[model samples]
Target: MSKAAVETISGESLSRIVGAVVGLAGFATAVLAGMTTTNPGSVTLGRALICLVAGVLVGRLLGWGGEIAVKEYLERYRKDHPEPEPPAALVRLKQKRDRHEQIVEEMKKSA
Candidate 1:
């Protein structure tokens, strides 16, 4: 298949990208907020790590769910609608093939 026809962002990849972005954002925010507190280094670090993990999980789940919902809706829509006709080129190709077959059969009968 052509590169353009290939799926660029699948459900899994989208989930991973969203998870990484959210995880980084949450980690950065937690660290910056923790910096202003009187909490010990270990506690601040712990909170930041927790936020990172939570953010990643939540973001990934949301992304995956959203992808599934969109695909389901599209599938339902497709089922409810009629498929389009074949392209003009394809129709022409089939007609040419039929003509070729007919000529071959006629030549065979004459021989």
Candidate 2:
């Protein structure tokens, strides 16, 4: 697909976006649990909000990164596999051009 179409694949999936955000939140919360000086079994609203915002930023980054990686991989695969030939009309046109070139060469030879 073209660049614009590929962009749609990255940002258009609600499920993927939500999944990334939730996954980031879980990971960040775990890290916070270990790194924070706060007491166990308690979280302040401000801290919680900070985590939420951080998760969202990281999640968006993760989601976009994943999509770009997949797209690049698929593009590499496509380069290996190669696309189908051009359409039938184009094939016919090329054949006609070749025949015309042959006829022109014959005329030049006779001349």
Candidate 3:
């Protein structure tokens, strides 16, 4: 499979797994909290809110963790197999073209 395809699949699978884990953990916490509380209604509402917040926070953490993992993996790969340096002239020309395009885009947007 292509690199792009592999990356996309890995990202989606990671997200799903993270989501499931967060959801399960949240549910378990809520249930435990509910069991320990005296007021059923208040406890249930509070537990639900806690679960929602926990799931969001956990998901965000997982996303950052995945990004870090990918960065580390790429760094290791680069270390193992170094790439040849591109011509300096060609790199400068590409940068100039990019800058020109950006200016043109800004002009068009302001028009």
Candidate 4:
């Protein structure tokens, strides 16, 4: 619910999208390379499938790398803004605790 949590979730989602795109691109590149470099006699459906799978795997790896980069960025941001604590459920809990304490003190004074 907090901005920090939102940012973290958004970053992760963005990384996944980037990864999928990269994988598709790698697949295309692999197909193209296979078509251009291999002999006509060597070309086969099985070989093409293998190339495609390999490309996708490479793309996924790149995507994971992207995710790591985003995580690093977030870590740096957290380090820089260490003061104003991230808005979270804990903040609300603390607020409630403080109000309860105040009420208890008032009741004691009245007694």
Report residue 56 deviation for candidate 2 (angstroms).
0.8
Candidate 4 all-Cα RMSD: 8.9
lDDT per residue for candidate 3 within 1-111, as digits (tens), equals: 123311345566454466567866787778777777775877786777779678867875785578567767887898888988899999999999999999999999999
Top candidate (TM-score)? 1
Best by lDDT: 1
Candidate lDDT (C-alpha), each: 0.81, 0.68, 0.72, 0.64
Please give the ranking of all candidate structures by TM-score, highest first, separated by commas: 1, 3, 2, 4
What is the TM-score (0 to 1) of candidate 4? 0.43
Q: Flag regions of model 3 displaced more than 4 Å.
A: 1-13, 78-111
Looking at model 3, report the run of 10 residues with the lowest lDDT sum. 1-10
lDDT of 4 by residue, 17-105 (tens): 55566656665665677677755624644465665566666766766676667677777888887867658998999999999999999
User: Which should have the higher lDDT, number 2 or number 3?
Assistant: 3
Candidate 1 on 48-71: residue-level lDDT in tens? 999999999998887677666666
Alpha-carbon lDDT of model 2: 0.68
Ranking by lDDT: 1, 3, 2, 4
Alpha carbon deviation, residue 95, candidate 3 (Å):
42
- Give lDDT: candidate 2, residue 72: 86
